[model samples]
Target: MKKAFVAFILLIFISTSRAAKVTDWLDSYNVLWTSQSKGSYDSMPCGGGDIGLNVWVENNELLFYISRSGSLDENNCLLKSGRIRVKLTPNPFINSGFSQQLNLRKGFVDVNAGNTNIRLWVNVFSPVIHVDINSKEKLSAEVYYENWRYKDRPVRKGEGNANSYKWAIPKGLVTKADVIENSTDKVIFYHKNDAQTVFDVTVAQQGMDSVKSKMYNPIGNLTSGGMLFGDNLKFAGTSSGEYAGTDYKSWCMKSVKPSSSHHVLIALHTQQTESLNQWKQGLADIVKGIKSNDDKKRTQAWWNSFWNKSAIRINEKNKDSEAWKIGRNYQLFRYMLGCNAYGSYPTKFNGGLFTFDPARVDSTLNFTPDFRKWGGGTMTAQNQRLVYFPMLKSGDFDMMTSQFDFYLRILKNAELRSKVYWNHEGGCFTEQIENFGLPNPSEYGWKRPANFDKGLEYNAWLEYQWDTVLEFCNMILETKEYNNEKIDKYVPLIESVLTFFDEHYRMLATQRGRKVLDGDGHLVLYPGSACETYKMAYNSTSTISALTVVLEKMIEYSAADSTKSARWKQMLSTIPPITIREENGKKMIAPAKLWERINNIESPQLYPVFPWRVYGVGKKDLDVAVNTYFSDSDALKFRSHIGWKQDNIFAACLGLTKEAQRLTSLKMKDSELRFPTFWGPGYDWTPDHNWGGSGMIGLQEMLMQTNGEQILLFPAWPAEWNVHFKMHAPKNTTVEAELKDGKVTSLQVYPAERMKDVVIMIKK
Candidate 1:
């Protein structure tokens, strides 16, 4: 009762916080995404870094602010405000116990742990930040004023308190960003990593040096006394030791507002010890580029076009309702993910979306500067796929293509590293390969709690490198056309992956006591089952299921008469059947061990339901399979979203639309801890950093569904919707669903090709 009451209070708080009208909330700024926001084919860092934004209209005066957070300010006007000032200041990291003030009057907050603070101070004046690395070395700073917008703007209409500007931040800089948005005066500061750095910002007022200093906890938690971090400490201001007297650069840019032609000034300064002239040239060129660009118009146009691609009919008849709220919110949420997809950092592995929070990190990370609470890294297959689910369904094919290019490139590196780690073997992929496939210093050949290399011969050995290609291959395969060169490249890579597994397989007659050489190996294990545990006493259901699918897929692609393809077909024949077991009156799918111990994560048995197709209501063993799923028991139900989790997926297929609706309502717990976003507390409740995207899938499943082969229209939406939904399928097919009177009135499909068993449900 106490838990439920607290949860209820939290829910009320969240609802109240999120209840502002869209117009009143989002009327301030507009966001757009494009090549700039998307980054380039061979862009620096090969990913899109996020941008920062500040724009407001107060007392008939426009208070506009932006930073080069993400190419948002391609124009460096802000970098060249009136009478630009330059100075050489000591860097912060070298010193200890010295507190530096880049911005002040916003007050200070401190973390209870290590006195670190995650500060959020906006005193109705400005969102300012101070970056004080260490108080020892002097650095240079530059301020840009009245700058043009970047080609990519991130604000959008109907957004409430969402960011309007995105500042592009390049990789490999040593500094901190701080803000104090409210006070008699607002302050923004850039604290440097070393003896030299640059401060690039835009401000309106100039020639005024009324600055305030503040000393807050480094971590800046809102509550608690300051505790200096062990290895990551924030230094002090009165303890400054050295200040440079070397080189400096300055520039000023002033521009008239586009709408009112109100005058605005931009200033920029740079300080460097070595080769300052090059810094000047680079700064100057970038500023010149910023000055010459037409950012506002470009960003607006790009965003306009993006939203026009599809429209949401929340109430279809009425765009406002509880259903509409969830639907439109979901619509906009998809757009946000689209903008951030691999935009920067190839998407986090643990927590893919809703603010990069990793599940766990290594202890040595303390010696590193990044906060432990900032979350963990180390990408895995389960999380990666979840992030992209909405992408594939939402007509963001461009993102899908970019993702493919990104992952394929990464896979090349992973393959090379796997060769080295697994003795140059063709099979066996490691647990966490680096972005470029080289292992990070901390994780390569790391020890595990489960006493096995996460790179062990698990299903991922075939799934990660190969299964990732299946959807793309399926799309291309459906075409039945010829892109011989592309085919040759992808096919060979795919073939090589298959060859590794085929050779790695150990032909044992008994697998977990099954008749044939079943689930005992990594990719083709006889005893080992889904996710390497929850095994059946006899057979490995997930292994054989995956192999059956993978092998069958490879054979299908190998041309009708290909020799190797013939062997793949033969291999499938030898695959064993899954063993069935009953436990306490419930049918379950465990062919090996009931609950064998392993260091695996996520529910792999559901593979037969999702990603890989082997079981579901449509399959032969539907009852037994579902029984396996339901019977698994909820020992850890919260993490799994157990009953309610699978309910959403199964409801649509079983035509139990009402149950699906109820489950979605239960799943979404709006609160500060939970971003009005769909991720949840994993029984442990810390937030399932990896499951944010899965909620979006349930949303689409509720609206439209596709069973590996065909598409479904309004397969699971509530009768109250009374609406129309238009969505794009794998091969560029446009599906439209028009619902009225609580049933589908008409289902239209403009399929690019022949459609599969597309299920279009109507009022019965």
Candidate 2:
């Protein structure tokens, strides 16, 4: 009773504090769609834990697409749990003052129309969706299941880009097999993969067919299904057929008990087991577990803590201004990230878990909910890193584990592939990695060039792009710094990843016709690429910088182990220096020492400024870093505060107050969509995770910067901007501050001992 009372009081205190911190901002910025949506394109996103729902009212009925993280199909593709449609007999939503709002504070959607108030919320702890409808008078409700893959569908061209270069590749790619379903109102549908799923296809494509017996196949035989169950409802009818060039299957369940209120719930489950009864039992357990209100309270508690982790609020300079938009969108985007707090896999960079129909996104695409621009199983390291980097400053450490576990799960396979091919003791990760740690089969280049190296990927952009893994390595180390995380679990991964470059490059140096060692007798990185740009380059700055920074940290962390520390120090010494060249009379960080031509658009030069943090706001050589930011032609040409853009990051790191604010304002502004947070497919799909993540990182960096015992406040903030922020830093430190009208009203640094590190940047 005492514990319960304490929890309740803590909840109340948090509630009150949250109200003071963000209620005004959320009220002014919550997404409010006044009219019915045209289609799924304009759906409102809502989710908790791993479950995601895209809710929208269409044609006098409410519809939503249900999806869950880590629910991959046979082809290693992320699958959706079908769509749900609810309609009332009285039709309260037809031309009757419709309003759909995503309540930011409560983390639920409230749809009000006519005399009905419909509340839609998903339980974070349990995989259950809740719908409660209340009306002035008793009314009947009909819930429908819309399944698109009822029958065996052929893998058609342009259906999805998952197969990758279908026109060029002649390999036969089969679509999903027939879905298992029943004709009853208590509808349950599942997709089961046989032994001959895409897992076999990818293994063959990557030339790992010989080692197929040794590979870990998560999709060899997997079952993922959803069940609809609710009291006060009975079987109404069923429909199975095609409509308007689309095939689908559905079952209708109608309210049996006549009451003023109606409650309906759906529980979803997935498993590696193939037994149908076991899968059914899993769903049954979910329903049973969610019946009690315990999970709901726990869910609320989880979200309550998530909202209180770290936050930022901007004083509204003017209506719809950039500053106001940045602040509001930061919270909105963070809400989206929080929805999948317990995802099995990391939230994807393209669409994360909130993707609607492809046909809805673009009529030309006309694909299923499972379809995304990149392959479903493919986790592009370049884009994927951006999605997780911001979690450090935001103090979303638990969320970072999903990504860490993803790499850890596949680490053994990565190391095995390297050993099998090169007889090495390291893990080789390409740009496009399958969920199970192999190059994406489709993008591995169907047509092999003459004498092409089998070990290296055939795709030009991904060739020799193993250094991207280091960013995640850095994230792991940084997590330890901020939280005192157990380094034992992640040390192997970091060691093996770094070992690949160390041993592989040295071996390659000996094979080259000419001596490939620099003046210091260090191995020269040749035949490398600078982030899909500067192909066939030597000494790529990004790769070198990654090796140098990660090696130093590894040595520092492993000081107790003399042998490991010595090896790390030696490797660090062997890394070539980051190149600097005079461009138009200004010295700037060069992408590489030598290269043939540009292949892709990415400013790897600024990597030293942000992720590596070799130079930053309070670091040495600030002018050179600042000059690189302004003078780099590639960065200037490709710069935009859109999807995957890092302009805010660079500006903030350089302490460019005005530029940081400007870029971040643009980065966080409402995207041209009904949902403000659905930023773009700007080189990626809708609701870009990288765009939101970069914006979050920029906002946090603008407020505070931590560099080696020094914590600087308002490092890159505009003098006129008034703000309130609390963010995590290294050494288990958190800095909370409020800046109002160019004056520091309050400041608090946790652990009081660390207060000496705080340096308030006051503008006069």
The numbered model that scores best in lDDT is 2
Against the true structure, candidate 1 reaches a TM-score of 0.57
Looking at model 2, residue 398 earns an lDDT score of 89
Give the whole-model CA lDDT for all candidates, comma-separated. Answer: 0.35, 0.79
Task: Write model 2 residue lDDT over 1-764, tens digit each, in one string.
Answer: 01111111211212112223434344665778888888777889899988889999888889898988877776676878888889897888876888999887667899999899998888987788888889997888998878887766666676546543333433455557546454444767777777676667667766677777777777666777777756777777778765324678888888886667888888888787768788778887887777536766777677767877777878865655677777778888888888888888889898988887776566787666767777677788888888888888888998888888888888888888888778878998888888888887656776787677767788767788888888999999989999988868989999999999877887788787566466787878987878887788899988988899899999999899999999999888889899988977888888899998888887888888878888897688878888889988888897888788888999988888888888888888888878888888778788788888888888888888877888877778886888877788889887666777776666666766776777766444
Clashing pairs in 2: 681-684
Question: In model 2, where is the ten-residue run with the lowest total lDDT?
Answer: 1-10
Residue 250 error, candidate 2, Å: 1.3
- What would the per-residue lDDT of candidate 1 be over residues 1-764, giving only the tens digit for each residue? 01111111211211111112222222111121111111011111100112221222122111222222111011111111111111112211123221211011112111111111112111111111221111122222222211111112222221101111112223332212211111111111221122211111111011011210111111111110000111111111111111011122212212111111111212122322234445445434433443212432343344344443343355634533566555554544444443333242334423222221112222222111111121222234435555565555555544444344444544444444334334343423333332333322233222234544333423322222223333334333323221111445455445555454454444233322454343342334433434433432233454555666767767877757679778888777766655566789866655343434433444555555555546643346667656655566532352333211434554444444676676655553332331233344442112343344555566666776555665655656666766655565654555655566664554545542433345554434
RMSD of 1: 17.5
Predicted structure 1: lDDT: 0.35
TM-score of 2: 0.94
